[model samples]
Target: MSKRINSPDTEADITLRTYLDIYPHVCFNMIAGAGSGKTTSLIKALSHIVQNHGAKLKMRGQHVACITYTEIAAREIWDDVGNSPLIDVSTIHSFLWKIIRPFQKDIKDWVIERVGEKIKEREERINRSGTRATTKEKLRKEINKLNRQANAVEKVPFFNYGTGSSYDNGILGHDDIIKMAVSYLNSSEVLRKIIGQKYPYIFVDESQDTFPEIVEALSLVRITNGDRFCLGFFGDPMQKIYPSGIGDLPGDREWKIIKKPENFRCSKEVLDVINNIRRTGDGLEQTQGNKTVGSARIFVLPLVDEQQRTEYLRKVQEKCVSISDDQLWLADGHVKILVLVHRMAAKRLKFPKLFAAMNDNAPLSFKNGLTDGSAWPLAFFLKFVLPLATTKLKGDNTMVMRMLRAHSPRLNKEQLKGTEVRQALEQLKVGLDMLVKQLGDGSQSTVLDVLNTLKNTDMVKLDERLIRYMEGNAEETDELEDDEEGKEALSMQNFFAVPAVEFWGYLKYYNNQSPFATQQGVKGAQFDRVITILDDDEGKHAQFSYDKYFGLKELSTDDSKNVKEGKDYVIPRTRRLFYVSCSRAKKHLVVIYYTADVEKAIMNIKRMKIFPEEQIFKVEDLN
Candidate 1:
């Protein structure tokens, strides 16, 4: 524990440490801005709790719960807290499930109630005027499905997460667990009391990204337990980029908002640019923690075709190299080129269909799950195919044999004759040959084609869900869906229909094997130099419009209406996103705007004063 955390130098009412010092009685939200030392403060707070109240909590069988956004983040906090048992660190889903897991009966009941509510909701929607027959039929099917689940849920032995959702098998979906947990916590006082008793002090990292209902439910626990439970949310409204997050937390008179105004990450110049970008939104000024200076520039270029755009990017890179006087600016994988969305990244890297499928209008949570290796086909490719392909290309048959021994079903059988062993090896060899033959030509094959190529081999076992999706949706796959769940399922169907090569590209960018990344995907990650592409036309998402936020484009009629009604989302969302992207640069930042009008866009940007005249560049037509 640092002395700064242990011995504070500020007023008790203003300092975050002082509030934790008044633990159990203190419940608040800590507004830690971009590059703010939020995690460091969190760790220090955990240490203070341990030093001050760890023994008492241990005696009472209670612990401090820190629910983070990702598993990687959880692990980092866990490692920082010395893997302390007193501090329970886990991802949001894991933590929610852990609290709600023991109440199987409640989960079952809640799920049934949830199904009833959905059925009623859909019925009401169908009752509305102008209901189409096709929509009516789809809603009827969804209602029928929910009815079946309501009946079956009562007999379900137990529910499980991180597995395929099955009405018969009692497996729950990712969103369901969160919904179920929050609903139960809201409705059941006993569950809230149990949670408060188990974890007396709960701190949610990236709380802005947490569902508003979860935050509210935790607040319920605090209210129920009174001073016995302390709840703190650590995140910045400016950093809330996810679609489902509680953008700006609703005003709570009970909770004190602690602002950490100093950024411990970015240098002065880089920090100044972000602070300016945030001024129009939150108006929260940030002071640099370090004395180091940085550089920032914005380049405006006329809209061009793919080939010309590529050349323009190269010229911009050359300019970045000149300004920084560092050859590393031109190096691949050294500078992250952040785009507006996955489609932009996919277009840049040559994977249109896969990216589009992933961006389908379903739960963003599921798409996130695919990258977390929860999706079997994706997981199989990363774990089995990529490694085996690399080894086969290297002519390392020994590694192939090793992977075969581990995964090959035929080779695992005992008391097999030499002939049978040879036969198994021959089958695997043939399978590998087929896979290699398809992939070796650098062809972008569909996942279905790859699955078909490997389906006969015993070594390349497929998940039943993947198989079912492939076979089940083969018919009627092109029909549009009216139901939300139907839409999500169709996304998977469309994904499987896309080229396997697109998935390779998807994972390549996902794993940082490629230099281009989506702004939403690179949250909390810093680079020495960052190149952010702000092309709203390429973004293709209706939810966020960077052009409108940056004044390069006019707001739509509905947008202007929403602003007048005080229901606007575009400005706040885009502002937060742009702030996040610009703040990722440690020493240098470059923002390239691909606009329809060079002069008009440049004039609008100059008027905005996000960057001064010299720092902003106007590129000639890249014809």
Candidate 2:
């Protein structure tokens, strides 16, 4: 009674066929690069289950459980499987939470009992006298420390603090989701049965990004149900860009490894560049032939001082403007600009200008940041305060207070008033509270009034442009439509549209940490161009070790001695980092330095040999 579809003539089709032929409660790991039809393969496999196996077993259904790392990805899969009679897809977090929420008491009791014992030990350290530490302070420190340790150990890998109960429920974050899912699978027979009845085919998209806990959870589902459930994982090992993602996949024995390395997203020239960089090592060689080809180039800018930096950025801006205008007539072809920083200071200094044009637009379509970095306090104000000003309680003090509390949760109301950030926070909080109260009370005109007020402010004007630009984008509209089903499935707004204000505010105060602070934040993300600003300061270079550079092919070995010896041996880790940064760009790679030290830059090029001298661009020389 399930609908079936024929496999198209694509790599996904070939991969799915191999999966069907074996059909052994199977785990197939399909490695494919971005835009290389990995999702298509997943779809094909799900369709095959509907056609070949649906109705053969009583428990099995056509519903395909598709898991991804981020909400964005989950939405994408939902869109792909939209209204399909034969399939149902969701992010693993959303899926597990849905099943577990009904059993909240059970889960809460289990987690609290376990975590409570640890909390008690920490509480004991503080004297019973109300003198030692407050309950919130104690809880905050202990929870943050436990979460960090859990993430470090890979036991609890993904934890986001913002958004909702799923992230901030004190028991579940990204890593906790996996642990809880695995625990549920181990203990709950009825739950397993329900999941089995709902979904027989488990297709984990971006499997390379999945941690061991997730794998264990999926494995349990398969084991509990036996032949009724089939597990299919799709990802490219080479593209396992996150540090935690390295060597995460099960070996060939436990799972069938299917290689799908056709380069569908890039040009031949681009593929060549990737291959050339990848082939420099001994153990690492191109397995799947490069099927993608495109024009790839590296642009190196010599670092001088602040003056030179400004001039360099100006020139780059001009180039971007030119490209944007030109691309209006042609396909923009996924242009991304990656600005790599050796330190936090460089990132703060360089990123504002690089993204100024886009950020200035209405409905701000472009976002820039370090992988897993903290949200900017200023950005939060821009997003939340203006909207809030439109409400009945339109006092500047309330707006500032809300903004402060939202951005910095560690401070209490008393502390909020005393702190230097007090004035700003008060204004923002008052404005926001007014806006929310007015909106909730159905005061549309009041909301418009706040908007008018904000229109006069600098932040409000920027947000207005951002709003306008967002409304004008056809692609965003399409993506919004595609994500509608996923939004409904998650019973939330499109995750991306969940206002950066609320999201970042929740993260800052409740979560008290940035998800970007970890490795998982940057996974599956890229830029059309990249600018790496290396810190030549002492002790910083040590951070660029082989282990730190897992995204590049060169970091697979111990070559620290060669690098230290100054034998012109590029630090494999540094090279890999450079490679990862460069690869993030779909078109161009830009390197910016400020030391006037062309020696280091020259040495790097000679050692890595990633690009010729002609490809390097001197920013000072540019018109």
Candidate 3:
């Protein structure tokens, strides 16, 4: 049974189709609000292209490219499009890589240039920091490692994508692929023509978070190719979360901004709050597509300790159940409690110290790596060590052998009789045994111990970034405040041991497999009832101060200056995140604020007018 309504064409669908009817493609940006059937609209657009231009595209050997943000989203679009031969659906990374991967020589040159820039950055860091031998030694290895790769790029036969970088093997990392593609597209008119010819029409979902450089490059393609190539962006700028994204469309007079002002997901109450919060920024109001009843409020609380926070969460669930008249809100996994950081949920999951060690007050980029299994050490464990160790411990030799055969390097199945292949297989098994002995118990083994065993066994080749971190070198992120000194690498010894089983729970939370999710993680996700827990003290990042955002405290001196200069980042970003969190509720939304000044917060809540006075409640009332 399809949940999609067999409704008539929305003005957006009609407008887009009418434009598609034209000969030369007119690139336009669609402002699709949350729960507004953005994907449905995108799917319709894809179908329209196939129906209208399918024959011509097939004749020219061209295809419609649908670029999605997440692999999950890409798969959904792929399936939704019926796996059409004339249409290609892939993630932004995969899509860009596909178009640009053929230019091996260009890739080599780009990578070398990029690595040289990194080397320069590292040398400058060493010059700034004086006389720290351990740090200098680590930097030396990094410099050497990078120099080797840069010098070795030309000898590589062909570059590959989707895998982490191995300069020796010609595989590029995620950032490298995207950055190289963007760079090539910007620099080469010939490349742009080739891309436009190959992908006559391209649609990028979640375009708000697409890198600004990529957005501009695509816009250039659209402009240069003029009617030959059409590019469509389907996203809401108000929902943008990452600081690095292009929140708004390129300010070009030629580009059209098509507004999809419909909300089919949130109920009337939820819609009202979203519209109000949004009005403070761009002031685009959403018309509720569903006429269902719902509740939304800004719940106020004084700064709370761990125990109080636990009790408050329970009470909020109870409140949601009573208010929404849905008993399911109390049901496990039925409601969502979105915190501002992984550490908050990590505390509840009993890995607070481990999470805190790596993540507390860390830049968002660093935290993203650890939580999402992108950071090298974490990736090593989850991808290589854990699967083999667990299968061995369970005595699942079939699974173990299969994993070993699948992942062990230099295993050529066709040449199984060869001594080299046989030795590699035996070595992998030995390595797996050593790994299981060291960390299988999930106790007393430091991260460094597990890493060394994995590296020694060649279970998997560690990423260069991981090598740098292990060498007491942490990569700096964009969010590093200007005044702060360079961050110290997280202590490998003090960081929690690989309790693999417990780590799954943490990973699940990151993937939104658990009821507890971070606010940013649930960008395109919604639930029946949602409780967004916000605390300035607990968030610990200088970037997001919900207190300053909601007028509980004054904006920092720089924040005010940024606003005056029309370069404000904090307030607008906070507003966008707040809007995103609040908009994710179908029946109810409880935005809990742990603030120092309840009176001021309450007063500001009234001024904001996003919530009804009666709906807002204190923690004591929840009791």
Instruction: Compare the candidates by lDDT and give the number of the best one.
Output: 1
| TM-score per candidate | 0.91, 0.58, 0.85
Which wins on TM-score, candidate 2 or candidate 3?
A: 3
For residues 257-277, write the lDDT of model 3, one tens digit per residue. 789999999999999999999
Query: Which regions of candidate 2 are displaced past 4 Å?
Result: 1-8, 51-62, 123-176, 186-198, 280-294, 305-307, 316-335, 341-597, 617-623
Error of 2 at 372 (Å): 11
Please give me the total number of clashing residue pairs in predicted model 2: 49
lDDT (tens digit, per residue) of candidate 2 on 407-499: 443334454454645554455445445545443433333223444334432223334323433344222222211122112222211222322
**Clash counts for all predictions:** 1, 49, 0
lDDT, residue 392, model 3: 92
Candidate 2 versus the native: TM-score?
A: 0.58
Q: Model 1, range 414-467, lDDT digits (tens) per residue?
A: 846769988888888988887776665477677777777667787666777667
Q: On a 0 to 1 TM-score scale, where does candidate 3 land against the true structure? A: 0.85
Question: Which residue pairs clash within candidate 3?
Answer: none
* lDDT for position 282 in model 2: 20
How well does candidate 2 score on lDDT at residue 264?
47
Report the number of the highest-TM-score candidate: 1
